[model samples]
Target: MKITGYTDRLSVQPGENIKFMVNSHYKTYKAEIVRLIHGDSNPEGPGVKMEKVNADVNKEYNGRRQEIHMGSYIKFDAHPLFATVDSFSLQAMIYPTTPELGTQGILTKWSPAANTGYGLFIDDKGCLALWIGDEKGNVEKISTNQPLIAGCWYFVGGSFDKKSGKIAIFQEAVISKTNGKFSLPYEAEKQNVSNERKVNIQPFADNNAPFLIASVIEKQPDGKHKVINRYNGKIDRPRVACAALSKEEMSAWIDQPSGKDLIAAWDFSAGITKKGFKEIEKIHDISPNKIHGVAVNHPTRAVTGYNWTSEEQNFVHAPEQYGAIHFHDDDMTDAKWDVDFEWKVPDDLKSGVYAAHVHCGDDADHITFFVRPKKGQPTAKTALIIPTASYLAYANNRFQDIPLAQLMFGRAPVVQQEDMYLGEHAEYGLSTYDHHNDGTGVCFSSSLRPILNMRPKYRHNLSPSLWQFNADLHLVDWLTEKGFEFDVITDQDLHFEGAELLNQYKVAITGSHPEYYSGPMLDAVEDFQAQGGRFMYMGSNGFYWVVTFDPENPSLMEVRKNYGNQGWKSKPGEIHLSLTGEQGSIWKHRGRAPQKICGVGYMAEGFEVSSYYRRTEESGAPELAWIFEGIAKDEKLGDFGLVGGGAAGLELDIYDEELGTPSHAVILASSEGHTSVYMPVAEELYFNIPGLSGEENPRVRADMVFYHTPNGGAVFSTASIAYCGSLSHNNYDNNISRLTENVLKNFLLDQPLPGAEKQQVLTKN
Candidate 1:
């Protein structure tokens, strides 16, 4: 816990350079390259097994503590127009989500150190306030009598007249049936304050200071500008004018900006398409000077603006109605740390999972990364696709803290040391499963920060067992023990390179939980299968959510949770992703069910204990007998495992013909004997009722399936998230290991599978 870090890249090829950024309390730390084979620390399983690799980066180095600054705002570079403004007016449409969280800046060019310039802000009392400071260190402020309400939109403006020494402030609520928390008759009682005051001091304009929206620049003791007074809410159509406009003119400017004195009018809906905003960082300014701005730290865009009506739900259909940009005080996309060291992968280095093992005194950390086969070159016939996207989705997730977590798991939550650190250090950022400070669901996750939960030997608090990254390592250790030559690839690589990356290998294997997937990643897998590349879906609940990477920054992933079983739901009219304009939610809602490609779909889940698979009657068919060559007819497959004491515990899937499972697909085995704790997934139920647990529901089970595709290709699925956790059982001597080995070995062969001909005939029929 004392030392932690992350890599610039999740997966690299031979001859590629990867950088590591560390934050350590100690003066120095030891570093070494270790190939991770197994990461589960459970004594019952193969304990954390990592092989030391002789690499050039293995050495002790001095360490420095790095700090992460968290906040989302729009920034414009210092321009000449900002410095020449003596009598000016500022107008913006504001929707404050957390107005009572102390003073927050809406628009400012003020310097906290010198106390100079003019600005508009939400005062400590949550009222609309105008502030002016002079070169003599004198400050004057005027605020509205009534406080602004949260979850409501307001048109706020302020103007300072140098000739008359008069300052006027306006705040009026804009309410619609679905635009705000309250509407109709309630708007009459809402706070609508307009005040005018006389000030003797002239405003000091600091042209050197950069203009910022939703935040103010505070000069630190070191003379560095640090963003402070971050506002948590939405700001739409902010306009600035060099002339001091009257209260009525200010209102007109807020509605439509058109005047000779207009300095800048920012249009939040610019560049937005029906497909979504690809270049999300650029904020276009519709002004003669073209003083544009850029959003720092990704803010939620394509949100409902003040003029939004309930008629249109998607922003692409009505961009003018969706001009709001939601800024959160806690939003963070990157740690922006200085690289401590960089290591260029040697050409001869083998493809696998590797990490920089760093330790100082008793505190240690492992910055993990995947080394894939050399670009466009394959050294192995098999490939292991690590679920990096899923890892990011749950990065630093506070699962145990979620309501009813203990009840869902059917036991007390087990909190680990890493989880304790994550709870206290929120600057590390929130996951897709977490909610922001203002209660909105987090839609974006980035890998630039240290992910405590993605480390080696880390266990999920909810499962109280190895999950995701660590759980996938169980298969890695098994492949090593069995002496199979295979390469490793990550979700990022798959998403970027597409199906061409998988074509280099004969067999492709998924990790223990590939739940989060982008459209291209799924297409690549399907294309690979169609091109005669065999696929092994070793995990359950895969290809579930629809996720997309920021085209500008691949490390950042975006997902809007709606429908299906979710931690939090996206707000109405905001379900479409801002990065791709694609509707965000489960892929099944888009008609691409997991069964359509992987031959299985999520059915039920439980964490108390795992059940065992029972061989089906179809396993005895002569064409499929080879799949069970090492097992007996009465034997229980994966009856014992490190996860939930068996392989079918965490989450289960089934071969549902109704959901696009191939008609030729055969259910070779099905699990049974699950506890009442396991319940059917929400997507399967049309109505909420009782008798939905595994004890009474027929759909609560894992089904091992096999089927063939076009061009001599094939697909195999072990529909359980805990399947890989059982691979290390009995020192890899168990039936589960034997079954997986038989399938994988056969899958790796150059020729077609045993039942390919029969499957082809079935498909033709």
Candidate 2:
């Protein structure tokens, strides 16, 4: 009950055994975790040994150090072992058995050797023995035969009535089962009266003796009970029946049925006719069909099934022998029909779909099923529905796809220009959509309004008529070469409900100058990609602003910018507007960054682009030589504008270098001139910054990145938009022609085209 070194008070019920958990010093002998009891105390009558409470000498130390004889001021070194809340109730109760000596030395006495055993005896034979404390301490013994036995155990329990002596002891002997079954108790067990053995009727005499506890195995640290006689010269008796029960016995007591608390064991309906059946409410089919009869096989190795349907079902199948799900009758076996033997689709199932059928018997009538080899899958089929605006220009056309006209002319409030011609005096062109036609029509004039107003901030240089035409042309050519298909309608061309479009197309393609998009168009594409659709950008300043168009109004889309509209922060007219916010933003608005977003913003760095390095065997250039099948390794990365420092004709330049790409994505090629941009908020800001933030900016790493859907459909992107139109603008067939063919074949056409050869792994010392 006495506590020390703890702030929290301990509590226990009446009659509960008290345990003092103390942190004491260690002595000469390596201290083992122990449980102690006073076995022998000095100068008393017959003394009992002090048993070890709990000690562990298992800890490895340098040496035993030194040893000391009895009473030589033992300095036991100790460490504090923190006690948990549950450790308080772990100590066992103690019963004293020391002072019942009868001067006969039969009931309690010291050993003749003076430093040895005290134990229990039966039929003039020692049955159990115990020693505690130091060699100089006293020992106790019990030399009576009634309670001690050689090969038998006596279980003492209670029977409240006194007629049969109130206390009952069943002397049941242990017997082992010869067969692998339960061991039954031995018969002919004896029962004896308490008065059979003569002991003076001293009702208050202490007869409990100390028991020695040590590990049954000499090498291990364990505890056992050894009973010792306190009276008979410390007769050593290392015997006490083991009372430990198996887990089943403890569970029986814990889960036994009770009458007072009578919880119905038969809570379930005994049968369908049971009154307890509360109209078994219709159970909905919550389990998916893919998991219906599936048995897990090698759960670690992911095999594609229903979960991988999106990645174009390109996952590898199991070996023929292990292919459990057999759809054909030729391969069906008794094992195949066994529902107990269905293959377990791994949680990490690869991206693809799997199908298998089983016919229980040799009849045509059978069950057919399918599994998508993916974990989380869309309920709807994945497909791509090209928007009406894109349909006009491309429509699978390589020569004259009208991606620009499809985007602009299809909407209301058509753009207008003056009717004018270049080259000759007689040449003239018609100004179709303009309200007031002037002599300025038919001139190829580029304005900075669209670029400036489309900025996410700074609205001063705003102009309605920006270089929309140029943006349109670039998008159209890029789309055509990439082989994207589209519908050719003005406004009401392409629209759908929910995330349906994403399920069809693996990727949704857009343009740089997609500065204007109707609300519905934006929502559709956003939902599409969010549902796992891949998206590619070919033009600059795409998804720049927010516009709402009403068919009822019959006017141009209402362009909202500044801090006025609800979505002004994302509106295109605000200047440098972005398409996406964060990584997963529905729009994922990003923008031009001469220094931050794009390494090269505005027209400043456009003029400095020049090709440097050529293909070299050491650089793994020849490995991708197939990508340039008709070109040599010595060729430049690409040929575009001449090397200069002034305002270049193009906004982006392509060269050769290395850039990091996502594991799931591929880097087809890279360029050195392309700089990297810095945008700390690109992750949290949920928007792309436009224009150069400052001179201290990171350069863009020009790379042609490729991303494929789970089903193997893909989208490709180049660092620069200048290569949008010409396959060989400067008689440079290697760069433009090779890239265009690769993009078109792999992405839009879904062709089984050749890819770069795997690079060899080199080991260095």
Evaluated against the true structure, the overall lDDT of model 1 is 0.89
lDDT of 1 at 122: 92
Per-residue lDDT of candidate 2, residues 1-765 (tens digit)? 010011011111122221211111222112221111111111211122112222222232222111111000001111111100101000000111121221211111123323322221222233222211113444322222233332222221111111221211112222333210114543324322221122111111111221111111011122322112212111111111112222232223222322221111111111112111112111111112111111111010111111122222111221111111101001100111101122233333221111111111221111111122221233222222222222111111111112333222222222221111111111111111111011110101011001111111111101111122222333333333344443211222223233442445444554433434445665665555445455554433233233332232121122323321111122111121111111111122323121221111222122123332234343344434444565555556554422111111123322212211223444555444432221112222335466432123323333444443332334455444333333324332345546556544444444432331121111111
Residue 72 C-alpha lDDT in model 1: 92
Q: Which whole-number lDDT from 0 to 100 does residue 671 have in model 2?
A: 41
lDDT of model 2 at position 39: 13
Which candidate has the highest lDDT of all?
1
At residue 407, give the lDDT of candidate 1: 92
